[model samples]
Target: MSIDQDLSHVQSLLDPSEVIPPTSPLYGPNAQGWAVQKDLHPRLVAVPTSPESLARLIAHLYKSHLHFGIRGQGFLSASAKDVLVSMTAFDEFHFDPHAEVATVGAGQTWGAVYRKLKEAAPSYAIVGARTPAISVGGTVVTGGLSWLSAEYGCISDPENMLDAQVVKSDGSVVWASTEPDLLWTMRGGGGGFGVATKFLFRVRPYPQAIWAGPILLPRQQLPTVATRLEAFLASNPDPRVSMFLYIIRKNLLETIGAFQDMLVVHAYDANGEEHGREAFKWALDIPGAVDQTGVTDMEGVTKLQQNVDKSKGTMRQYWAPLFLKTLSAATITRAIELVDELAKQDSAVSDCTYLIFELFALCDAKGSCAWPRPPGAKHVILIGAGCPANASAGQEEMARNLAEDASERILGSRTVNLLANGGEEFHDPVMIWGENLDRLRQLKKVYDPNGRFQGPIRA
Candidate 1:
């Protein structure tokens, strides 16, 4: 069928408020979230308010040859000519105290879920992203990292994901959690495995309040501080404490606007601040370093999570993960040298940061979810580079090349949340899934025979 024919079908199925035509003023800004390139635009944007309505649209889309992109919070960095489906309106929140589980709609964000949960149930918490704006469905489906990851595992661990309400390619509503095969795919397999309208996450006991925050230090101290941090990880003192190392080249905020390498320690202790202080002892003890630690609630932590919020859609960006086998002084030294090299070019590695994601041992590959930590990897080294939105084409390429070059130095697997930022760059499934690629492919074939769902895997 023609594009107009498809538009007309969607128009007849959903209300005029739900379907945003190409000419609608609301369409342009809504589409702007995912369309990083100015030249790219969607043919149409659809927001179905209910499952029955969304199912109808999916049924129609499946029968037609139209390619569509699924969106939650419009966080995608890629823009295609296909129709974009926004699941923002399918909002539903229900917590089962007896089963210790929460069923959240795909349209909800971690912040929203946290707020709702806070008002209703304060004792339990769902594993999710640090930022409140990030969607629940997108993060959990991609093996989301969290402060509690050491105690538990990735947010999308198969054991924690009890069930999912999925909309099949054929337009039928099926409870995917009933089958082990479908449940495994939903856990860290990425959102291309059909439309998951509602996700059931296993809730864990959360502290009513905890002590956490960042402690800044001079960039010159990275060598000594990193060695101590390596020693801290080697101790394996407590699973509740997490550490993130930020080598900020663009932190022109304080201390005469000088660039510095900062260590932000996160302690999930409900009782004492001693463990968090010990975890980052070397850096916190540094003279002239800024102290930003305190005892606070999750809301305080969410507010502190405003780290890289400045350049969301306003810049041309590239981000990817690097898995480090160990956080040795050698690795830290190599990273500092590379960042210094990139800084010489233009200093675009401003907000590029890495976290000491301890406890990959907690992530067991015995479940159905295909997401696994790289063979011997321990820390998640996330690298990012960004330039102004109006940056010259050559300049943008240079920035991406710099980040890619830094990532090439360390051999690691991919993180799920960042699967969309590969603009015009093809990321091999093998690098992410390894031997599990074949199994994911076979499952994709069974669930979606046609190449309809364009997720991370392309079998």
Candidate 2:
């Protein structure tokens, strides 16, 4: 069939307002995503309002041998020129207070879901980071880990997952939770398995207030701060607390000195005033030039704790996630050294080059859903390097070299979610693809035997 014929087929299967042809303004427009460097342009973009229409659209695409890209809030990396299937039109929500569950459409943003749930139950706990703009579906599918991750576990924990409405590759709509195996895989398998039309997530009751903010310390105090942090983790390893240590260059000093400003520590505690006060005591004990802290509501806490406005604009950020058996003093020192070296080279384009150390205790492996996790792993430390999009070729090369050096310095199992470098050693098919690849292949063979849904990134 001609391209026009294919367009007409899809149009007949969807609402007029839901379909965007190649010539439409949003088709080839410079659409911005979370990653500033990547441009989003699709062969065609389709937004389905109803589940039946979505199923028909999938069937038509499968018949035409055209694979499509799925998007939620246009966040994350952009890949391929295939037809784009946007889930923004499917924004419906239902909350069951008795079941402690909320069923929401894939297109709905976390901000919307949080607001609705807040009204239904004054103390509903949803797994999400500070970014209110992120879509719940996107975050959950990618193994949603946030501030509460250390305590309640990752958002993909099966105890919290109830069901999902999905359109399989073959255009068959199935309530996935009916099957245990499929449910386990789909919870954290990401969009590679299928298009999740709706998600049913478990919620919990939380306090009305929280304590969170940034604690800026001078570079000279690294040794002291590191020692205090290590001791604090050793003594009171409460999962209710989350801490992020950023080794950043001084924004103003970048133009003046050889090395930028020192480091800043940001921490969060979901527990109310008393717990937050106790948490800040550790920060006060550490010798630092400046200390900025606050107590606020859940919404306000997330906004202050997780905002990354400095890393905005066009920049190519590469992430490397490490799951350490333990963050020993030796490991902490090594991490600090790596950050110091990167700062000296001026490798990070903006304030982008930094290490994010996330400490969590994942002892109860069987309690959560079957998302990929490092066997016998306890703590996770993600070391990321963000560079400017318009950086010179030589600078970009330096950034890559710095990332490699940092990864090699830290010894631990790596996570596929943060693997961006296309090097051969890091390109383990099993790690990157996870079990979702195999499950996707099986589903594809059963549903799309003709391989009509092959897109830029083949599942």
Candidate 3:
């Protein structure tokens, strides 16, 4: 059948308000997430308000031979060519204070969840990476790692994860946590298994206070700063301290060719006031060119971390992660040199360069979670770049190429997320795309045989 006919057939099966056509303003609106790839106009759009409507919509779409992509708060990097399913209309928040768990609808944002949880209960699980605007569903499925990951664990860790209501490929709405394997796959696994309608997560006690802010340093002191940071991380592996380093350049005349004053360091402390103060002092003493630190609550910290102005046009960003068994001085020097070289490239691309080093040690209930870990992998280093959507296509390609080349030169044998670049094939023997892809495909066939769910731009 033709695409239009298929969409029409699916639309016939749902309430008029639930289905939006290509001509609708919401079909290809520019309010979606940071990636330009997610801007495609789907043949039709479905916004289900309840589990029953979602299941029915899925079943009808399957019968009509149409594929569908699930979106939460319009935050994703994949493109869609068939039906686009927006979960915005499904927003619902419920917290069981006694159980210390929050059950949230797929459409809710971290900000929404935070307000509801704070009002209903004393505390809740740490939401997305310091950003309240990010959608809860997208981050949770993709192994949501935040500043708290070092202390607690990735948001997907099974101990804290109670259950999820997902609509499977067969148009059956099943509670997935009942099965062990299914539960494990859903946590760290991307959104390929099914459309998660609800999440049941263990919430922690809210912190009485928080200390978080940024530290700016001269680029020339990066080498020395790197050495100090390595030693500090080794000696004091405090989960309360999280840091991110950036090497930037700009095309503007004043900052052009200037690389000295570009590095910024961001740290967060979730432990109470006294401990937070000590952590800040320790971080400031790391022998950098400059340092700025302060104390704030959850709301203040999150707003600062995930602040993306919606007024700007779509954003094109890329994220790449590297896992290291140890953060040696030599490794730090090599990484610094690589970043410095890349920073000399086009200003638009170089200005957006960000390097984040995250330390993850097995904590109290570590073994209970399902986050995949290599035998000795202890630290995760992520290098990311973001640019305006209207930036030149050539510049985008150059930025991606530079990121891949820099990663290879600095860290020889490390595993990075395959989905970061549309699952682009990598060269390192330790990085096996075939095995990961095969396992992911098998799980997809089992849970989403018809491939009703969309993610990662490939399946």
Q: Per-residue alpha-carbon lDDT of model 2 for 402-426, expressed as tens digits? A: 5555556665434433321122233
Query: Would you list the C-alpha lDDT of every candidate in the order shown?
Result: 0.66, 0.63, 0.63
- Model 1 per-residue lDDT tens digits across residues 1-459: 688787788779898889886799887655655325432577888888888888898888877777777777755543446677878886788898998888889877778888877776887777667677767777766777766666666777765667888888888898886667887887777657788898888887777567777676776777676677778767765666665665544355466455554544343444447755665666677765777788876666666765444445676666565545566767766766665766667644333323233333233333556675554454665665666677778767876775565455643323332222232244456656666779888988887788787677767
Pick by lDDT: which candidate is best?
Answer: 1
Q: Candidate 2: how large is its RMSD?
A: 4.1
Please estimate how well model 1 matches the true structure, expressed as its whole-model Cα lDDT. Answer: 0.66
> Which is the leading candidate under TM-score?
1
Candidate 2 clashing pairs, residues 3+ apart or interchain:
158-369, 250-260, 250-261
Residue 417, model 3, lDDT: 29
Q: What TM-score, computed on C-alpha atoms, does each candidate reach?
A: 0.89, 0.84, 0.85
lDDT of 2 at 459: 35
Candidate number with the higher lDDT (1 or 2):
1
Please rank every candidate by TM-score, starting with the best.
1, 3, 2
| Tens-digit lDDT track of model 3 for 315-348 | 5666566665677767776776766666576666
